[model samples]
Target: MRIKICGLTQLEDAQIAVKAGADALGFVFYPPSPRAITPEQAAKIIQQLPPFVMMVGLFVDPKPEWVTEVLKQVPLDLLQFHGDEPEAFCQSFGRPYIKALRMKPDFDPEQAAAGWPSARGFLLDAYTPGIPGGTGEVFDWQRFPASESPSWILAGGLTPTNVAQAIRITQPYAVDVSGGVESSRGIKCPTKIHAFIKAARS
Candidate 1:
């Protein structure tokens, strides 16, 4: 029942999520995402965080040099690959990373899990054109291959209203959310954050 609130831009919202007992905070580095935050900005937010709170950096198909440069600036606790990055590419950075799988109707989670052995976990999210993640859409929760996969993070369209049910069904290692608790595209709602976490933990 770990809670990760993604797409945090404002320090207040980030702090609020932390106060609300979020296990992790995700900062999108992918420019195309509305929730995207620059490395410098992300650093400012990260610097003020309390200990034991995980800071995750979300990246797409970034070049090796760019990823290295970003790490030099921001002390990210974990890396989340939300695009088409090979296992070698993700592992080359020498950091723990979570691989995101854009689940389609016919996607095989077992096969996807085999491709990313080094990953700390696998995040299952909805697939939509022109958006890497945070589509605020839910797929068939019952379709995930949890029996075969060791680690899985359920994402997409999860909120306080249905998160408990989702957790009951998926029993994921963690839950990564962005748009589900948003006030807008990237703005998080503190009330929503509290409710979501409470539901998950209950």
Candidate 2:
């Protein structure tokens, strides 16, 4: 299973995550998020990351100019849209992006993903009243769609202790963790990061 360590802020933490067998590193661009990092900061961290490690940028309902500006500065391998962004708008960037869905009782994964056909994958996260993502709460794992396509990324409330169980149940193409391995709002814990990845893989 692929592991994506998200909400990364410090360079040391990024390095630690990468070394601990992370497949991708996510940098939040949404200002409202406590885990958000500036383009300059992300750029510096990205430059130092070793080759083959994917760099992801997380955005929410951003303006075209802002996304353009971020792309020019930060060399992101993927774009994660965690809010209400239309397919046309998402495709206009000419980069690979994944659409994040906030899980509700009646939300349809394939039906909602149908619009963004260009999306590289779909990330299923927990729904909160005002939160776009990173709520640190797990939804019903049984809600995972029974699709043959290898494009589902499971997220929300995954930790070292429970990631193995989550993966065993969902069998997602990849797994994304933000707060599960975090020591604080934005800071990642190396011990947690290492433990999480090890557990997920096992």
TM-score of 2: 0.98
Assess candidate 1 and give its lDDT. 0.90
Which residue pairs of candidate 2 clash? none
User: What is the lDDT, from 0 to 100, of the residue 158 in candidate 1?
Assistant: 93
Those runs of model 2 whose alpha carbons end farther than 4 Å from true positions after fitting are: none
- Per residue, candidate 1 scores C-alpha lDDT tens digits across 24-128 of 999998888899999999999989989999999999999888889899999998999988999999999989999999888788987877888899989999888
Clashes of 2: 0
Per-model lDDT: 0.90, 0.94
Worst 10 residues of 1 by lDDT: 143-152
> What tens-digit string does per-residue lDDT give for candidate 2 at 9-87?
9999999998999999999999999999999999998888899999999999999999999999999889999989999
For each candidate in turn, give its C-alpha RMSD to the true structure in angstroms: 1.1, 0.7
Best by TM-score: 2
